[model samples]
Target: MFFADNLKFLRTRKEKSQTAMAEELELKRTSLIGYEKGVQPTFGVVMKLADYFKVSIDALLRYDLSKLGKFELSQIEQGFDVDITGKKLRLLVTTTDTNGEENIEMIRHQAQAGYTQGYNDPEYIESLPKFQLPFLSRNKTYRCFQIKGDSMPPLSDGSWVTASFIQDWNTIKNGTPCVVITKEDGIVFKLVYNQIKENQEIMLVSSNRSYAPYNVSIDDLAEVWKFETYNAFEV
Candidate 1:
């Protein structure tokens, strides 16, 4: 149900014609139209689309989203800039250990896939690797997440990024190093271009020029975390 909506949404958002998008997806124009008209694609095609769009399968088919109580019709109708000034803006869950040390949630490469569904789940947070950083004792929530690819090297792959959760998205400065959790791209650590005023979207810039910059909607954000430092993954 939502797959059709999401597919069409991505196609139009990128300003690509139906034939062009179909060819890109290796789908015939008529097949693409049928898919848009609510025909379910094969598993392979679904995975291909998910990879092509850099979104989770769940995001592509968040079927019957109204039942989840996360989306509202009025929000779309008004078309505001997704003002998250004082909202909860859920991210990694944290807790104080027995010794009063705040446990920082650490999401590694293996957990990245599950994070799409479990980022807000308390049980999932409990299941992830957690540790305490002595210097990060400020009155701010912090979490550690691993980046998997070379899009932002010399950071390299599997680097653990410890970052502070940003509650007010508007305060994000352009060119700031941050980890953005999105509906489509999942978790991406990149230089953020704050374009809320001009486009109501954030542009993610990869340090590696081989990977081009792309735009993400503020509405599709799960959370934003300002980077601090990172630990290299053990080989």
Candidate 2:
């Protein structure tokens, strides 16, 4: 099992002492050592470790390559038609050609309909074409929004961005760009770096080297969404 290697990497990167990590997980130092030494831990212990590290079991075990086929199959098995009512949705830009531009127009029309719902039924769920985004295996519901800042630089600007919900944190990697929400600010997209400490602090690194990284407390985070990609409208 790659558990030992994974544990060691995470522990060293986090700069966490074995004893300290063990105490937090209610595990003995010897057990933690064994995990780092390639001892295959039980499923329960593996789950606990995965939770402690804020990673998926597959990620912690480094089984992504071996389990990709199985993971896709599992997603298929679990996939089901979801009703749009009460479920959050966003629009994703699929292409940049004329067809893609037409799709954006269609989305705008739907948004207008939803906005003018008072003329009919305010709760009516407007149906729009659904498209699957690359990188993200799951089909995402998207909504179009205007990008207002240079934080995302070349990728986003005063253009349309399709925002989607991010439910899993394990898929997030250090230094990868993402849209994060805190209790204080609703949404801000930037590169996220794993902080040195396990405390609430997280380093929000900007892609533009000119800007400095800002530290934010984890307790203030309400949501963190990965910016899959974007289509920029030239100004």
Candidate 3:
């Protein structure tokens, strides 16, 4: 019913005693009991519980206590939040590195069609190529995509661009390079602007300058991955 009920539910569901949970959370048994009995935990302790329980803070605080092991909550805890629009999207697919760390998935040109409709489908996303880069931040979620044309030249075709996943659209900085995935435009590499922030639209600008910039509604926007780094090859 509340955070206490949620915490106690997860602990008892795991068959762990208050003392054991306290030991695991590095809190005293009495403190654990207090937490279970409606005593609010500090932000630090809340974070500890969320991590130890392998669930999101939102789930720990708001989700049904009965659904302790649901995939969505577990996925959120694992740092896999896919915020694609057009539908209520949540991707649970993750590929692990040799060290058992999850890597970002790379969307190939051929998969663009399926990606448009099945981006939210775990089966679809899981089938994409996934790899890790040593330069990538472990805490941030990322993805690699290869551009199709010279729209953003002289980067050219087949150049691999890696971008960090952006969940909040408002945080999108104006004039920043990004890979904008939408229903109308499957995927386009362009400079993004928040000029239409109040209208829930983004202005897409091309580097070639010959192409005029246009605005797209956020509802049509599927995924916006902000450019981080790119790998280019010379002939």
Please give the CA lDDT of all the candidate structures.
0.76, 0.54, 0.75
CA shift at 120, candidate 2, in angstroms? 24
TM-score of each: 0.63, 0.40, 0.59
Candidate 1 has its poorest 10 consecutive residues by lDDT at 65-74
lDDT, candidate 3, 65-118, per-residue tens? 454235434454576442223234444345677788878788777677777787
Global Cα RMSD, each model = 14.8, 12.6, 12.3
lDDT per residue for candidate 1 within 108-180, as digits (tens), equals: 7777778877888888877877877787756888888898799997898878889998887768998999988
Ranked by lDDT, the better of candidates 2 and 3 is: 3
On TM-score, the candidate that comes out on top is 1
Residue 86 of candidate 3: its Cα lDDT? Answer: 23
Sort by TM-score, best first: what order?
A: 1, 3, 2
Point out where model 2 deviates above 4 Å.
1-136, 139-145, 233-235
In candidate 3, which residue pairs get closer than 3 Å at backbone N, Cα or C atoms, i.e. clash? Answer: none
TM-score winner between candidates 2 and 3: 3
Show how many residue pairs clash in every candidate, following the order shown: 1, 5, 0
Stretches of candidate 1 off by over 4 Å are 1-81, 86-92, 233-235
